[model samples]
Target: MAEKGGIHVDSARELFPRVAEVPFDAEYKFMATFHNMTDEQGKPVVRCCVKGAPDVLIARAGYYWLPGRDPAAVTDENRKLALAENDRMAAAGERVMVVARRDFDPTTFDPKGNLLDLVQDLTLLAMVGIVDPPRAEAKDAIARCHSAGIQVRMITGDHAVTAAAIGHELGIEGQALTGAQFAAIPDEQLKPQLDQIGVVARVTPEDKIRLVTMLQQKDNIVAMTGDGVNDAPALKKADIGVAMGITGTEVSKGAAVMILTDDNFATIVKAVEYGRNIYNNLFNFVRFQMGQLVAYITCYLLAAFFFVLGGVPFAALVILFLNFLISVPVAMALGFDKPTSGLMDKKPRPLKQPLLSTSQWVRIAFLGILMAIATVYLEAIYEEAGVTTAATMGFVAFALLSISRGLSARSETETAFDRDIIHDRNQMFLYSMALLITILATELGFLQRLLGLTSLSGDQWRICIAAAIALLLVDEVIKVFLRSRLHDVKAPVT
Candidate 1:
């Protein structure tokens, strides 16, 4: 029996009859070794042998072993044939390994200086090909990445044929380049071809760094994944470094920005989806908060200067209630919104794209102005009754209007009543609760006295609700107009 790193001998045990069990000797522990010999019919026969890469082992072997023939001296033609066989297996996506052995006497053997010399002039024994297929979900994950306008490339240490074969199965497009070929390309020429390289085979750590740098030169946000110490430098250089928690070296994990606990590529795709959703939710939060601030500020300024009110539209306590109890809750709910349908179908946003686009600002401005007009008009109509009554009307209307804007902010282009807004349990529940709280704040006698507010009749409440509904209707019209004209410009929302 033989045992060593990089090869599993137990799987091949069935090839030979089990005469007896033998412990692996530490003396012949090299990848290429001559472990034990047996006497069969008065001739010494080598039992267990060498194991290493086919190309490396074949070069050291001086003779070839075949069935029904004496060991024959290796010729140039024979070496070519053996190497061709290795390539054939690699092209078929199999991991090929070569076995060989050398005759030696254990009593006098001395492994000094370079122990590798012990494998010279060896007899070539056999070649093994093992199939290693990709994970079942890998192809679909890759396809999803492509749909999202993210290009996926495979950088590997396998032979070009092997890498290419695997890349094909994984849905990676473009030609595969060996590391040597990729390195040979001049910097000026390589920059343009980075996108076209689907696979870089037989890559060294340096090659990975160069590829990442070249991609960066083109303004790409590169995400590198690795599990070895040699990959640390490249992983650190990447915009987003991903390490495999299960098999990654400590150095690699330390250098990476993110770790994949399951060591699956599909998880990377899922992360991207989640990241996009968070960004969208943040955008909505900002949009809704900004629109409400614009409405409140614009209403107060217009009412104080133009209308009979001398100062601020609402009292300090009312402002506090509207901001914390109403607006803050809705904004927080918007922050946790789920990813919208067809989110992954859209292209990745450009790095230079602003958080809010021109069209989005225009939409926000329109909504703010419209809400402000409704608030000021209501205040002016009820000013004759009393200042407290007018402020109460404005307060109730503004609060309801802000909550309505939160729902419409769930989407940039879709209607406020889109399924994403109406069916979202979190947003809908919070919106309903906020609405109920607004009504209670007005009707509750203690709240009215504390906040210097007045209760509203059913008709006044209906008017406030109608104002909120009108704001949504106007927002829907703006969304439709933007959607129709957005094709002419850069639509960053998608």
Candidate 2:
């Protein structure tokens, strides 16, 4: 301690070594390491001696001191001044703390290991100031979170001024209150006004649970990030708890739903981005599959009654091939499509909304009606032909309709030739593959005999092409209408 350039000015202790006593267990509360130092200025021999030092060391360890004196005396003036100075330092973006050492008149009062003897008379020691700067990436990360509509609040145990100063430096502005202020609110008033809180200081573990609960009461999808044993309860109560893997305690990690390995805020933004893309891909698959499902069921059921009321148009084996080989592959391709351009630009979807929305079902119904009408018209044209040829024509027509919807399912904002449409090349390839398999099943003799398919003539192929192109027009028109001002302005991800 002497080599560190710290001057040990033990004016009263060094001159009276016998006046010190051992630092008991309870004295550590005021950050008091030892209270056994002798005050030889007042006493002769030290009954029990310990070390006496200024409050400078204690303050550096993050503690503030409280000095007491008579009601109308000037002795405690310096301690009050020290506390005020520390508060000013705290408001200037520095952590300020204080320390003290006290001694009792062992003669006038019987001294023991009790509070009356320990806190009899106090001596102000020192105040400390510490500055811990923020990281360069922190401000940028916070800004990104704001853009993404994620609220970032700082919960700390520092003094309110200290927390506010640091928050200001980190781009977190607004009113900040201490935990005492928050807890003072009546239970009835607490919930109604909880959302306005921005920064909380001098917060306890119990305060954390209260904050999490209040935010949840406002219907927030809370994502609490914590890395301490005290943070376990809040982490568990959050909707999506994020724990710091590197700095997080075992208890906190166990309570969290996600753990950040690097403990970086920017990573969370990246996660939201990818999460939105994944959701879009999933719904894209659903929309594509559902749209075609409606069309196929409508067309096939109508054919069941009109063409093959007593018998099946396509065998069970052929239906299996159609579903597995054609529909499944297209659904998979849409499920893995790239992120759309305006995915992040839109607000988050409501948690309670159904997977396939009402609007989506309406679109599916429109496509279904069109496909059924087109199939019935084509089947009527091929009525004079044999049952096998008429059935094959209807199958080819429905296959064309499914392919049209699959490709059109790429985006609501882009057309077939839009430059961004190139991202769906894999999807287009699957469509081509599905078409090739359908043609082969119809043309091959052994497969045709096995699957009950008849090849379409040249004129029949032209009619199927016309029906497909017409249905594509219908799909595009409805998409353009939905993307207009009549409904949601955010373009749907197909």
Candidate 3:
């Protein structure tokens, strides 16, 4: 049946008839047959004859049928077909030959036309015509890798022209060099030329190893993919080695970190994306942790500074207590927040880039300043009202900072009011921890005295809550503006 771009047969009978089936035990001594047979003198002895499969055949006597053509016209059509097929196989890095049979003598047989010769010739034919095509996903995967700022280079033992054609089909960039090209260069010369070549063709096993080393010299994190025994050494040397589980040699499989079950390049792309996402999330977690540490250090240092100047009032201790108990948990919650839309679009950050960027430092500094200002304002109001009223206000401010920190932990991608953040079981656990710490600190005499003892009146407590809400709103607005202007700087792939 005709299919898109090609033909398909549902059964063998559609192409050739199965007129009879030979019995399993039937004694069969196959003969080496030839068509258009000629002796050493080159004279045709026989034109054509019908027969069963031959035990062996001459290299020049095998015939192939041309689809939609009559068998009687095979002689004329086959010559043209042979030329075309030879060119096709040659382009695909395959050797090609015609196979034919010898004329049989009933009484006298020549040893030169022996079964061994036929077998050897058939072996050569099989070797010449075989070619393995690239996987369907190779092109798309290569393209995606290019888009992601990853370079792909193809190394194959095929002839230079054939390998170059395959590289072109797979979208590999830059020039292809032969194994000889690599071997001729000294290490000194090769080290400087690695960037100019992308496809290495007609390469020996040793050449692949050297090519990998050259890329590494430039500090690239190379990923090697191989399916042969010859590929093991290079595969082992790569940062990430991939092997084809279906067709890979045992040595290659043993050397690789990952195996492609279907030998599909697309699977590798998916794996890379997953790896980047995991790393990105880990980066976010570390950043959030550092923010907490900064907050803790800043609050403690300021409190110490005030104490050294004179005796720190109980109200000041209340502010520090609230900042630590409330802010740190909220920051932890931020670690689990969903990533922004352009998370993967940004290039990977450089390995040498500082963990905290200038923007991040500025944000942390501003947060500390804002928290310090809010504490000072609450303490002043408490002092004006009376000692009892002031103590109550201090307690309220402490509680408010704790809750406000939780609200602020939501990422800039989402608002604090987003139900998802509040409902997260992990966030809930952190919030619970913060609340428990606050209550324990307030109830324990030593802790309460250490932080400056305080109990809140209902009215003063309400004022503190109002103040916390106002501070959080201002903080969120500042974050929104900053995030709007701050473009994501992608990390460089080293």
- Model 1 TM-score (2 dp): 0.87
Residue 37 in model 2: shift from native, Å?
A: 12
Compose the digit string of candidate 2's lDDT tens values, residues 287-386.
7777767766776676676754233545587668777877777777777777777665566666677887777788778877787778766766676687
Misplaced by over 4 Å in model 2 are 1-140, 165-174, 308-313, 410-417, 424-429, 443-446, 454-463, 486-494
Note the residue pairs that clash in candidate 1: none
The sequence of per-residue lDDT tens digits that candidate 3 reaches over residues 243-313 is 99999989999999999998888898888777776665555555445544554455445545654112233
lDDT of 1 by residue, 1-494 (tens): 24645555765454434322222222232264333455444445434366766776787779988888889999999999999999999989887877776665545555343455556787887888879899999999999999999999999877788889889988997989988899899999998787788999777788999999988888889999999887899999999999999999999999999999999999999999999999999999999988988888888888778854565777888889999999987998899988888789789888889999897788788799888889888888898999888888988999899888898898888777766657678877888888888888888999989887888888999999999998888888888886788665655765
Off by over 4 Å in 3: 1-138, 186-193, 258-263, 307-332, 337-339, 357-363, 380-494
lDDT of each: 0.83, 0.68, 0.59
Q: Which one wins by TM-score: 1 or 3?
A: 1
Every model's TM-score: 0.87, 0.73, 0.58
TM-score of 2: 0.73
RMSD in Å for all candidates: 5.3, 7.6, 10.7
lDDT of 3: 0.59
Q: What is the TM-score (0 to 1) of candidate 3?
A: 0.58
**Comparing 2 and 3 by lDDT, which wins?**
2
